[model samples]
Target: MNPVLKLTDVTRIHGEAPHEVLALRGISFEAHPGELVAVMGPSGSGKSTLLTIAGGLDRPTAGSVTVEGTDLAGLGQHGRARMRRTSIGYVFQGFNLIPALTAAENVALPRELDGVAPRRARAEARKALEEVGIADLADRFPDDMSGGQQQRVAIARAVVGERRLILADEPTGALDTETGEGILQLLRARCDAGAAGVLVTHEARHAAWADRVVFLRDGVVVDETGADRVDVLTGPGAR
Candidate 1:
């Protein structure tokens, strides 16, 4: 099957000359439709950098990033921004919801930003909320909801537009175990529903939800293991 996202020898660096730090070093990967891949690494290992570059939020100093066959390096800032708005969805560690907006309103924000009518955008948001099992909390603001519920709302917002590629960075970091599992299940469902996803996480259990888990160190992919082959690490060590 064709990949929804692809990265080829991608590299990112900060500073220059002797003081430069490489955030990513010739990384390459692919995510096909109906697949969920996990990027596992310790802090400062370039997992987040890879996600941002793949999503077009950050430019790689070398190599290429493509989404659904479109070369990201070829696009200007405005073009990349448009691609992010219309083709990719992002979920961050923090549930970045507007404090004053209700769950429905938060989910509809992206569509609204894209110039869709509020009424239609809201209807779509409702559907997304329902998909994430949070429709009943549509009227609740972020402060009024539990951490799990807030994260669900964030997931609903991320997937509301049916984006081809979903990039999640430490998506369950703030939730408890049970709640984290629910969030992982939601992401799994997205893959089952035909959206490819790249999940950046430190927890092995969370990475187990993905079909494959890749380990990175010092800005390079150093290891890869299938979920089924990771049973030993998925127990208490996963925490």
Candidate 2:
């Protein structure tokens, strides 16, 4: 299958030479459409750095990242930003929702920013919310929902458009195990619908939901394992 996302010998460094610390070193990987891959590591393992570079939020110091076959290195800042806004969906651990906006409104923010009509954006947002099983809460504000519900809204918002790639950073970190599992199921459902996803997480249980888990240490990929035997607490079959 053709890859939807690929990272080739990618590296990111901080500070200057001598004092420079490498966040990522010669990292390479790929995710095909309908696949869910996990990035696992301890703190400071460079998982976040890789995700940011892949999403175009940060530029790599070296190597190349291509999404949907287009090399990100070739795009200027503005072009990359536009591509990110349109082709990729990002879900952060913090559930970055607008406090004042209702669920539907929050989901509509991206389309609105892209100059989509308010009515049509709301319709699309409703569909996304429905997909995540949060349609009933469409009029509720973020503060009015539980953490799980809020995260679902965030997920809905992330997938509401024509986005094909989802980059999730510790997506379920804030929720309890049960809630986190629900979130993972939602992501799986999205993948079943043809979107590819890369999740950065420290929780082995969370990583289990991925088809493959790439483990990172220091600034490099040290190991990768298939998650077929992984249960929710350790492997991919976790409820």
My TM-score estimates for the predictions, one after another, are 0.93, 0.92
Error of model 2, residue 152, in angstroms: 0.4
Error of 2 at 117 (Å): 1.5
**Per-residue alpha-carbon lDDT of model 2 for 79-109, expressed as tens digits?**
7977787788999999999999999999999
**Overall lDDT per candidate, in order of appearance:** 0.89, 0.87
Going through the candidates in the order shown, the clash numbers are 0, 5
lDDT of 2 at 212: 86
Off by more than 4 A, model 2 = 227-239
